[model samples]
Target: MSRRPQLTGRAAVLAVVVCAIAMSLAYPVREFIAQRRQIAELQQQQAKELDALRKLRDRGRQLQDPDYTMRQARERLFYCEPNQKCFVVMDRGKAPAARKPGRAPKPKAPWYESLWKSVELADHGVSR
Candidate 1:
């Protein structure tokens, strides 16, 4: 006949407590793993942003140099030497082939132009 070891009340209570602890820890372990993955993703994004910041800083430093500054001014601002004449070619709604160098048109008045009257009114002297 095989004899089974009988568990005491204290041992049964201890086993139940251990099982409860294990069950409670499971969710926290899974949540911790998910949070670690998210942290890695955020760190990767931070690295990319830092790299972009460094590249922009390098570009700013290059712009401070005389050659790069002069080149950028000439291209973007249409700047030339003092003796050289600068011609600005503009094309309106007309044909592009027949466009000539001229000044661009001015901006039109807004719809509420009458509301912005600023004429000097004549002041009449008040007699006491």
Candidate 2:
């Protein structure tokens, strides 16, 4: 049978050089891919910012119109003309519990009397 070719010194050296080149290029290739991804992300962010800018510009144009400004003021700030009356109708379901009248209602009885009353109520299993 024909003998297999042995790896000569020059051939081994060439193989090592090829492997070295590949290893050296690996990191740069990875860095190039990473940079491309970052650029894509930045482009997407720029597009979103441009859309928001357009919306704000439209809002600015709307605010320049006196009729729109007056409507917004009337709706948002409950404003009315000199001859007009404005009444606010509150939703009872969303209203806070009615507070006792007066900043600090004077205790109807002295502190000790109130404390004793609370103790009696607790003893009878009653809650205010």
- Please tell me which predicted candidate would have the highest TM-score against the true structure: 2
Query: lDDT by residue for model 1 over 2-112, one digit each (tens)?
Result: 886699788999999999999999999999999999999999999999999999999999978999888878878988979988776666566755545696667887756
Estimate candidate 2's RMSD in Å: 7.3
* Alpha-carbon shift of residue 118 in model 2 (angstroms): 8.6
Candidate 2 positional error at 32, Å: 0.5
Residue 109 CA displacement from its true place in model 1, Å: 14
Shift of residue 48 alpha carbon in model 1, Å: 2.7
lDDT of each: 0.82, 0.93
The digit string of per-residue lDDT tens for model 2 on 1-128 reads 98867998899999999999999999999999999999999999999999999999999999999999999899899889899988877775687767787677565788999899999999999998
So what's the TM-score on candidate 2? 0.62
